[model samples]
Target chain A: GESVGLHLPTLSVQEGDNSIINCAYSNSASDYFIWYKQESGKGPQFIIDIRSNMDKRQGQRVTVLLNKTVKHLSLQIAATQPGDSAVYFCAEIRGNTGKLIFGQGTTLQVKP
Target chain B: GAGVSQTPSNKVTEKGKYVELRCDPISGHTALYWYRQSLGQGPEFLIYFQGTGAADDSGLPNDRFFAVRPEGSVSTLKIQRTERGDSAVYLCASSPARNNEQFFGPGTRLTVL
Candidate 1:
């Protein structure tokens, strides 16, 4: 989902439920994509990353899926917990420049 | 192990004042980058450095903003005649290679009053 202005698109899920956050990227040549979690007053922490070559990459409790055809990516969190609540962002890096372009973040609100 | 660290975790300055934000990237990381993140928005690229030279500064908003990586490890972002709009979280990141996973530092929250 996309956001505008001062508001971020929010997703509400129950604790222990699976959560999926979707991001539509703009760059067609982007070879690398990463998922980051940001809590209040803190910097972004890396969750997982997926290269364009693979369609799916799984971590401990997280999985990243990249659909290069439509330029879409998604992050799935298994057994979402209360501490999992935070702002999630998807960033991509182009080939020429190492600069990362970040997508509008999605706020995940895990309810107990 | 120490990750990237930034000085002046929080900075407040009057408009038109000059400010310098420092970032110490992880040792041996060759590529460093600067980004600005405003409230409710994702971080925007500001600059990138390769070694002691600026690899790309096209992301910089204007000439008033400049960054330097003096020894290819420590970097400082300088903003002259700062305006209220300059208030945002400036984040610095580093990577082992040009196209690798980047490690980010706790951003320097700059508030131009």
Candidate 2:
């Protein structure tokens, strides 16, 4: 069965520090990947996305690195803030199917 | 400019009851999706619609679950004979097109007792 998994269930970071979250996917046919953040009592918010052709994509304060060879994905947040504390999810779309298969989230906790 | 919206932010129902969840997508968005999130887990895809028809429904758990997008803008997910296992947060999302960035709505929490 195709599935996505996270390397850790929780990540604690100090304020102003950088945070890294890791994920692994089982499907080789997946081409597009996205990272989302979800706060308590809210929906998953889109953070950044990367296609299989690109290994790295950067947003305002976040970065997504993809490793096709290892079937690994990671999300990096710079200058972590208290607002950045949330559960992060990595999702992938297989081929052209619009459906997203999401991994169990990794909770990111930023300490002041 | 509004994001996806779902009605009845929360619903409480009993086993063997029927329930309907609604989702209103962003204006002009042609693609709509529905997902389910269990406690301490990520959202799971249920179905996606392109315009007025469902493009993929293979993620639907069983025949008891059904969804419809009659006008391509608003979607309704209906559950028949709901079970305790059906309790979860139902999320809706919309995008300008398929394979694009999807904006999500505050999910509807369903509690089946």
Candidate 3:
């Protein structure tokens, strides 16, 4: 069975500080990993994604790191803001399949 | 352009009743997916469609759950004999293709009492 997991269920950070969220996946064949930010009463929004061949990828204010050797994934937000507060999820594209397996989300709270 | 959209922002029904949830994917999106999210949990995959065909339905929990993308533009998820455990937020997403970035809808909150 394919599984993706987060290292933490909740994280709190002060505004303007950097926040790091970690995830672990069990499928070695997973080639694509994506990060999604979900706000209350809304849908999951695409954050950033990393391919198995790459170790790192950067977006506007976010970065995703992948460690194939350890089957780990991480999302780093620089200078987190109050609006950055949301539940973040890590998902993987199962091999060549179109199906995506999502891990438990980590709620991030940026306090002012 | 409008993003993915779902109908019936919320639905409450009695257990054992039938229900239908609709999703309208972004125009020109080649792939669409359905997911179920439980309270405080990540969304779980339910089904995927490419064009008008169901590319994968393995994620569906049981025979009571079924989904259709008849015209490839709109999709509907139908659940029969719903149970209390079926209560959750049903989410819909669309991507240009497999492994592509997915854009999600606001979701249809389903409550089975």
Candidate 4:
């Protein structure tokens, strides 16, 4: 069975600091990976994504690093702010299917 | 009107009852998907629809679960004889094409007591 999972269940960071969330997947065939931020009572919002062909992708203040060799993925948020506090999930897309398998979320708490 | 939307934000029913969850994808989107998320767990793929037909239904847990999208815009996920363990948040997302970026709705929180 293929599974996408996170390395931590919760992470606490102070405002003005950088935050990193890690994910390790067992599906090597998965070509695409995405990061989603989900605030309480809201749907998961797309943050950034990376393809297997590339190892890294960056958004406004977010970065996604993919290590296909070890099936590892990580999301980096710079200058973490209180507004960045949320549950973050990493999802991998299955080839040819619109299905995205989500990983156990990492709850990020940013304190000012 | 811009993003995916779900109805009845919350659902509560007794065990052995049946319930239906609705999802409205973004207009003109061709791909719709259903996912289940239990507390403290990640969302699990339930089923996927490409246009008016189901392209993949392998993630459906059992016979008690079913889904349909006749016109390919809105979809309904039906659960029959729901049990206590069937309680969870049902999430719906839509994408313009296969494997493309998807937009998710707020999700329907189902509690089977």
Candidate 5:
């Protein structure tokens, strides 16, 4: 089955440092991608999104980079803060269906 | 502006019982979604409603899982003959339209013992 997967299960980063999380997806037909942050006991929160036509999209302090050739996506967070400690997931939307297929999350541990 | 909201933040039920989870989407949002997330994984799509109709429900695991959005606002996910595997965090999200960013609520955590 086509799926999205993360490269690492846990990523430890020191406060004030930059953090990067990577995801690989198998579906070549996916046209949209999103990154979500989920804290303890809470639902996933929308972070940033990018379209397949665009290679990169930037948010406040976050950036999403997409490589369509390799079917890869990455989320970069600048100046990591303690509040950023949570599980991060990359999801791909099925064409026109708005159904998000998520990858096994990567836990971002920001150490203060 | 309020985001999505779910009822019964936590539910503990025995096996073979039935459960209904409710979702109150953001005002005027026309799209609502339901997902189930186990302990160590991401949220899995279950159903989606667009303006009082279920546009897609391909992700529903089985016939025991059902959902409705009769008024195009509040939606409910009903599960019958619940088993231990049904114990997971049920999350609801809403978007202003299709292909838009979804706002999620604090999920309802169900523990089926």
Candidate 6:
């Protein structure tokens, strides 16, 4: 199936530690990828995005690395905080209509 | 500026009933999308609208599910004869034309019994 999936279902990190969430996608034609953070009752919020042409992208305290070779993608959060405790999702956009497909979420538990 | 908004944050319904979910995108956004997220799973694409017309309905699971954006700003997702399998969070997102950064609203949680 041409699906995007996460390598881990849950990740636990200390307040000051870095956190990494991984994703694997099967579609080679996928050109764009994004990472989103979703709180308990809110919709997923865009954190960062990287084009397939680029291998990496960085945001305020987060970084997204894309490895087209292994069809893998990762989101790295520096100095994880209690506010970062949420379900993170990765998404891909391709084709003409410009639809965004999301991957299974990985819950991040940041302990203070 | 206000972000996207969805009406009736939560809905509880019985099988074989009908329900409607509404979405109001950020002002000036031209592209709108609908998605369904089940527990422990990601959001699945349901439909996409550009302007007042639906550009893609390929992701709709069945004919029972339908949506429309009449004025190109507000949209509605209608489900007929809802089934238990239809229980999930319905999400609405919108972007400015071809902009890839989609702003999503707090999804409407639908519970079917």
- Cα lDDT tens digits for candidate 2, B1-113: 67889988999999999999999999999999999999999899999999999989988999999999998899999999999999999999999999888999999999999
Chain A: TM-score in each candidate? 0.89, 0.96, 0.96, 0.97, 0.97, 0.97
Q: Compose the digit string of candidate 3's lDDT tens values, residues B1-113.
A: 89999999999999999999999999999899999999999999999998999888888999999999998899999999999999999999999997788899999999999
List, residue by residue over B1-113, the lDDT tens digit for candidate 1: 89999999999999999999999999999999999999998999999999999989989999999999989999999999999999999999999989878889999999999
Question: Which candidate do you rate higher for DockQ, 5 or 6?
Answer: 5
> Between which residue pairs do clashes occur in model 1?
none
Interface RMSD values, listed in order for every candidate: 0.9, 0.8, 1.1, 0.8, 0.7, 1.2
TM-score of each: 0.94, 0.98, 0.97, 0.97, 0.98, 0.98
Error of 6 at B51 (Å): 0.3
Worst 10 residues of 6 chain B by lDDT: B95-104
Candidate number with greatest DockQ: 5
lDDT per residue (tens digit) for residues B1-113 in model 6? 99999988999999999999999999999999999999988899999999999999999999999999999999999999999999999999999975468999999999999
* Candidate 6: stretches off by over 4 Å: none
lDDT of 6 by residue, A1-112 (tens): 7999899999999999999999999999888998999999899999999999999989999999999999999999999999999999999986777788889899999887
Better of 3 and 4 by lDDT: 3
The C-alpha RMSD of each candidate to the native structure, in angstroms, is 2.7, 0.9, 1.0, 1.0, 0.8, 0.9
Cα lDDT of all candidates, in order? 0.89, 0.94, 0.93, 0.93, 0.94, 0.94
Candidate 2 regions exceeding 4 Å error are none
lDDT score, candidate 2: 0.94
Q: Rank the candidates by DockQ, best first.
A: 5, 4, 2, 6, 3, 1
Q: What lDDT does model 1 reach? A: 0.89
Residue-wise C-alpha lDDT for candidate 1, range A78-110, written one tens digit per residue: 999999999999887754767777877999999
